[model samples]
Target: MRLSGRAALAVGLAGAVLAPVTPAFAAPPPVTADLRADVDRNGRVDITGTGDQTGEDTWSAGRGAVFLPNIDDDAKRCRTTGPDGKPLSDAKLAKCNDAADTTVNGAADAKDLARLRTVPMAQAPKDASGTVRVTGKGAKHARLFIKRAGGWTAVTAKTTLTAAELRAGVELGLEGTDVVRDRAVWDGSAVVELKVTAGSTTTSDKVTLHVAPLLTQHHLQRAQRMLVTEIQGKGPFSRAQQKFVKDLDTQAKKAGVKQSTVKFTKYGDIWAQDFVEPAYAGMTGEDGRPRTIRIMLRSAQPDREAGRELFEKLRGPDMGVVQVTGVKDSEEWTLNSMGNLETIPPYTHGGRSYPAGRIIMGERKDTGSKPAKAMRTLLASQGLQNPLFLDTSWLHVGHVDEFVQFLPAPGTPRGWRIGVADPDAGMKLLRDAKAAGHGKTKMFSVKGFEGMPAPKETIDQTLADKKLRADNALAAKRIKANLEVLKRETGVTDAEIVRVPALFTRGTDEGVAADRMPLLRRIGGSADTPEAVREYGQQRELGKPTGPSVMTSAYVPGAVNGVLLGPDRYLAPRQWGPVIGGKDIFTQAVTAAYRKAGFKVSYIDDYYTYHLGMGEVHCGTNTLRDTTKPWWRP
Candidate 1:
């Protein structure tokens, strides 16, 4: 039962005053004692005390007290009825008498009940197979007490010390065959008080215990290492791709950055960053060292096999691997770590709190309501108070990195700013390039088409240009809609969003006649056949039927999909231009925009494989960063 401060005080005072007190005299020689408490290798607190004294002694223990001030009047002892059926009004009188008794006994005053120093206590260490050793000297007898929600209780079953081993001038072990063996008192922190009295002289000592936590995952500091994978020459990587890798390595070396490159196998595993999540904990490893654990997500079979390979190659006693089950795709795990918070997609069951507490997820209008509700419930059950959910279904690839990114910005009002892709801004640059006589090139004029028939020399390119413009306009509208949703959900103003120029494009379908011509080598038979000329003439009349396409970024690798190397450095995809009437305008504008926001931009070419596969540089790499702040504070 819970007790009011006054009620607790009344009860304590009643016991102390009613007990008999021996007559006071000149204090005997001061007792000398030493106390030590240590946790050993057994997850137990082994306490011992040793001291010396002369003559017969009396041993006692005083428990620590917790008092609450300004208690309700109705709960005060003075306002309550006593056993005599009368209102108890002797609280002040009892305190005065108790103070007199303390003065008579030559002990510390008991007038102020709130500031009593009874016994010291500490939290136990949470490490496995560890023990706490507590020793005390200069005391003849020792008593141990553990604090709980109700109050302090003696470590031994009996209140009085009856064993000779527990008497003064002897080394006493508090827990073992001779002492209490209950596991309850050993769980939390304990307070041990040793008191020895010789010929009316008494001395006491107290010591506290503390235990450290085993796991912690709420810190996101500077990145310590950049992780990449070899291309293995499996996909179509041009010389530009090779140059991009060389440039990246050169820059990294110049910065003295450490890197880990996973050897590429024949298996299709180019994106190393999207598979795992690194979480730090305070537990000792098998080799008695502390480190982080890599929590990998397995989606498809190939991806799972690749993840297992990495895990087996890198796993250690300190650096372990944990697999997250039932994930829809690896893209769902592409999260932004923000110290105590992580931005991820809602795709898991309830009760799993990853990367610490707070989570920011996105909601798609296309996903059914029941699934969304279940995901929300799962997140809430994991103690995520207010998760930020954005609408990302408008884009062809519904991933947050395709549109938004968070980076360190010391100069901004907040320490960081969110970068959002702006297709409208990209279209504006394209329009300016077209006005300067850049967008007049026909689709048939594009290089690397051996079998396609030559386009009519007199054909006008205006319709093709208009179709491209229409695609960009549609992309701009979708991007605007997503921005509105982000602003409404995140409460981040437009001023805070750094608009990066980017665009999107739809994949070409093979069934369409226009789509098939670009990939075909010849429409009819060989040059020897007479029908070849006639077939070519007829094909010209079909005339690139207003191109079937969708909304895609102007740049092949989206601008927003770039990776932030650090607070001041960013690595983006290199855009080859002069395709949309804009010769390198997309790259130039993107570089200028990032530079204006206090970041030095480095362009890395990914056109051959990564861009073609609908990804960017950030999607292909991962980083291990140091955590600067504590999760509890944020």
Candidate 2:
């Protein structure tokens, strides 16, 4: 009976009809259909057999004073169509505003008013949360009301208003973009400003609003299981094996996980694609939704020419290179230098070449054309407009010196000294020992010290006594010259060359060679064992486990967690131990390069295994919208 936000009403005045009451104390007399029909054309169709107060109005008002629906000349032009789609002769559509298009029957008579009443009013849902913050310029002139118990309550009476008042206080122009409600969005639209007022002043607070779901999120728990097997790492799988792997991946897709094919180049062909499948752009995943996978290729050598070439090629159409003229050669050289390289000479170990540098290339996959454009086409290729040289260093081939530059901005000094303390606790022990000076520590007697002052077994001593530096320098010079030939042969620049650092430890055909005690361990088990080799193959099909492993040295920056600059580092897959190990070197270096390029980086080790290598961290995590949730839950 109350006047809600909607513009329709229900009228049943039987009580007033039964008793003759005064006009002020009684309800307004119900108009009769016959009288209404005389004054109005539109009439209520009693299809539901509802009562029609045609001539029941007991009170007869002054004939001249009585008012009727304004059935004007323009209103007469409009008519209501019947079920047969033909206009009714007795009724015509009402014309409230326009003379064309939208037309409703005029409520000239009680029957017409009854017809008007038959036009259903817009009612709120049974349970509706009616208040919503307005967004964008659409908030201007926007008026909404609170709905409670299936009825709209006008919190602001006469809810419609001008743009200024509609904004609630602030001025908002209505010419900008319209507001849209995006359910999947992390942050809602940026329109209404949020502020906290204190006394006469107001301070702007965080204005971004996170869209909360109307329903609870579904969570699932996962279990871990170990798998073991042995098989040759190579080639096109049997149809049966492929089907089996496909089934497993299908299951993984349903479980919201990913599968990857890891191929160790050392075990077979170097040219084998890591993972291959039909384009996923049009593929529907297990959840009956489109599947999206982002492939991030990272290698140890940031300056790997081949890798860079491939990356550039993948970047597609926008393959034009950026050249800064008059830029200092040192800066240019630093920027283009191959990222990861060997720290020591005789770079070859175990009949494999340790890349003097590392380079990695990759692409991010998506179901849309945007990611494809960034990864496959030439649109918005480079994320960082002008990448600054973060740091550079070399190994035994040269001096272990490094240079690092920080972004020039407020509160950040242009440059600062960076140190490389061994994460392996070696540097900590040395510092502790130095702090607790000489006399406090017991020393072994010189008499029992082997070789009195120095051990003859030291590789350093042996190399020095043999004039190894000069011989090694000449050998390195020859290797460099040979590299020049290889470079010419490959047409790859020295800056693109990748080098691998030697591993101090090696793993035997048994377990990790019984002597190595590296704090960090790469996930891939050694290929030396037949069992390990088989397990590696099975893992390729089953997918790698999400786990962490040991890593050699990591670069450290004050503000950045992933990037680092130290004496020297290198990566290689073929060459094992004290030189080059497996492919992780490439992955880690590539991850680091991205960090230096201004992208946030996170490391997840042992995500999966293929052939004899482990999957990278980036391969496991997927980033959605950049809406950040507060870490601390209240």
Candidate 3:
């Protein structure tokens, strides 16, 4: 009869067998009496039995033993109890003199009883896959069962173990596939119980199966969903900004990908760029199973309320958010294609370790400083062997994204490649444009500020030309140095590097200059006052009274600061009709470059919303990739 629910079974036997000893007196037969058992779904077993022997019988309970051949050493034996409902001493338990003698067993073995024996079963690891192969001796004709809420449920129909296979000692595939469909049943791990019956004796063994966690970012898979914050332009959306969002939605729809728009009210909150960095830390749950998602957030920002609201909307069983204690923004963190998270060490509350599968990559610099030491300790504890460190102090905003990015390209030898912004390449394009009669292009044409006096006009024109040369030269030098560092540390070759056109400028001391100007500019004053011109030149001391400032577009908005949607798709910043290369060459060059690199480029015009704020398309957007790849393969 099949046993279901929480009910137990009890069998009573009243048979006696005679034992041979002395010939003179006849010995009473040993009695086999009632056997009561309670087996729970959680592998708890309890048994109680009684035996009676009377008149000249040298029969003792010690001579007979109860055997549980299948339980492991941890749960192999049963303790004896007295009639008073208390555990009996081993010495007192040995004397079974009366007909009413009884033997009681505990849930698990405690006395190391001689009759109880464990089966030699190959148990799987705690984090084993859904399907585990259980193999061992005496496994033939075994019945597999899974522990459920009400009681143990037999899974022989779903299992792939035949009598022949078990007899041959072949591994039996225990199926726990229902975990995917019934998540509430199995919290990442399941227990498989195998009951094997040989003749009249039955034995059981158990194994735990674990399921792998979800992958968030890595070369394992490409992003299928793009996340963008809805433009609530406190400054009012420019035509370009409006078109950018519309084009993004159009492209996403065409690619069969979903575009998730995070809503916010505040103007400063619209720059979702600095809020949270979506990452999967591969953390384990309370039951020792991998957690699905962990969203890393920045501790310091201009608008925390906006980020918090967005995080609340995004948090679910498959996703969670963790705020980093010492970091100012998520721009300090970057996840490479190899599943390695690169981050800068924060000042306070930084040192924390992560799990094994997810690698943390950090850079060590300025060991003498307290913040640097803190960062070093954090990265060291987090299990990074050799972190990639580059000097970003020269740039107004020091971030890895400003200079480097990783792209997926199956056609490449490594199946991936790195894109580095080349200021020199941008300068070369600028020089070519100037040579082709584009030098006279008006640099800045604000409505109220047009048609200035002779000295201002000359100074503006000179400063614009000089700023381009100085900024490009400094940026190129820095890029060269950084490239060397990257090559030495990561072993990435120049052939695998895609040089994208980009430029940088410094922020002024007073923070007024939108773009930096060169130190030298000959301002021609009125021809009447030579003395006035000399005094003006002395007061200026070349051009800048203060220092250099943040990066601004000379000809177009940040072209290289585009988003890589997938292997074949890219979203580049549209030029907004900027006169570069003697024509509107920003769109033409950027599009051609991406297309040449085997990407279908989609131009996004974020000139007014993001570019005016010294950021680009990528700064305003993010992507949550598909985690279909099996992490075990990596």
Candidate 4:
């Protein structure tokens, strides 16, 4: 009956479809002023920027408009908060100046102000002054900024503008990145109105605010730039990790995407993609082109302080990095959130086309341990991606990127296909290699790390291990279960799926350590434990469906979990399968699969770096793509 903004925005994050545009509250109160903005792509804020001259009342007929919240400048460190507003180190000051931002409730930078769409009130007679006001339940969380010679001033509810101030500029901004504030997730819907009177003439105009969905993925493959951590720390594996960064630069150049490397001199966290994801929000303007903004979303689980500082390092023009955190530390299990959350490419499913695709995360069907609630709520509030929950409780790391990925398939119905792990195919590949007389060839014949020697086993020996074989069989079964969920949700059939060669083994003697278990679990008992490591008393009592100790891991680098370079290039983790003659049989299989699907495969050696850490190329790098496509319908 009523368009309750709070109730509508608070819908369940799992298996929930957010309405792209929340309709105006049933029969809004009559507007009393003239508050104009560039609602149309005509390059000017005027009355003609609408389907009809009824102003915001005609929003349903034509309401394609939006503005960035502008909180991304908080990317770098608090350099301005230093002594005398100066940093101790000159280099640190330089870094801060590059991304120099304002206070939390301060004015926007020059670039940010430019990108912020204009909010101009109707011009009044020569000496006439007026007051511009914004109201509605959605107005509380956003600020209506007014510009002056000193700086831009922020007003939340309402403000009076002198004739000169009105002419200077007036704009709106979000107080913070998250749509879900302490109370409600505010969908950008505020009625802006202005009252002006002169020579016995009083008039007004009103319009509705347009909100843009902060989106990620498939679009990220269209990244203008790519980034990976520069692991400068000295270690036995440092050289190999540095080589990995070089490899990323090489691939980026080949793909024509700019490569950015951050000095991880302190943290040495080479898993760049895990800490942050690339996203964007914008609206088309009068020039028949998109007014784009580059953004990065830092993961909710701030396990690494380096990640937060890294956000400050990554901030640039029209670009910002943000993290929506909770009041307290997120559950340790939520560490999987960033890696688990990924997007499927644009596709039509069940007679509907998702031009911007869907948001997916690795979550259990019955179990409740997942990403932070605030993080999920913020994502779902965007509305473009109807987020889905896939079962990944079977994994040791519990990430979706480990086993499943989306590829550009021009020939497929949706112009894309899902690449998923197939343990059976892996076994078949090994069996075929052995049958070809390479059974005696060493499987991991090369040293994975500098000090550690390669596993002293041949293909024949590995195949002989009944437990290893059984591990793969069970892994394949679980993969299929998640695949079925994907099929049902995305309308993807077997024809649209690509089977990737993958082997599995129980990695650690105890799969998930007692420390990694989810918080608030009753396990073999019925009491909620809110702390991380204290949740599970004994590792064997972990309430995992695959028994207590089965933490399935990729026996070799899984090819599906690789970095995607758009227009047909893929960077897969180098498969260290048995080398027969000049080529590795496993490498040959992986290459053939991707090559057949119209993508050229480049092997990235992660054995010493990420593979040893139970990750691959995709886990090590993050991409920012071209996402200016209009997500709203006519």
All models: lDDT?
A: 0.40, 0.21, 0.40, 0.62
Per-residue lDDT of candidate 3, residues 170-248 (tens digit): 2222221111112232233333344543334444444433322222254324556666655433223423344566677
Candidate 4 segments exceeding 4 Å error: 1-33, 41-44, 49-62, 74-81, 84-129, 146-185, 198-203, 285-288, 327-337, 351-353, 512-548
Model 2 per-residue lDDT tens digits across residues 28-96: 222111111111111222212323223222212111101111122223332345579964331122121
Whole-structure CA lDDT of model 1:
0.40
lDDT of 1 by residue, 1-634 (tens): 4555666676687974433333344333344323333222121223332211110032111111111111111112221245787543323212212112211111111111111112122211111011112343211122233332334333443343222322222222221111111113332223445553333444565444221111222212455566554534422232333455566676555544566433434233555544444443221212322212232222222223345544334433223333332334322222221111234321212443233333444434444211123223323432322355555434433445667777666654444566878767766765666566655543222233233343432113432455555656776676677667655544456666788887555433321223233322232332322231122111221222222235232334677777666657788877654345344666778888888778788877665435544567765565655532322222
Q: What's the residue-level lDDT of 527 in candidate 1?
A: 35
Q: In candidate 3, how many Å is residue 546 off?
A: 14
Which parts of model 1 are misplaced by more than 4 Å? 1-220, 233-246, 259-266, 281-303, 326-363, 369-387, 441-471, 508-555, 579-583
Runs of candidate 2 exceeding 4 Å displacement: 1-207, 210-258, 262-391, 394-462, 465-634
Q: What is the C-alpha RMSD, rounded to one decimal, of candidate 3?
A: 20.8
TM-score of every candidate: 0.52, 0.20, 0.53, 0.78
Best lDDT among the predictions, by candidate number: 4
By lDDT, rank the candidates, best first: 4, 1, 3, 2
lDDT of 4 by residue, 83-192 (tens): 78642332342234212332333332432331222334345434556665566764653445555555656653445656554444454332323233223546655565
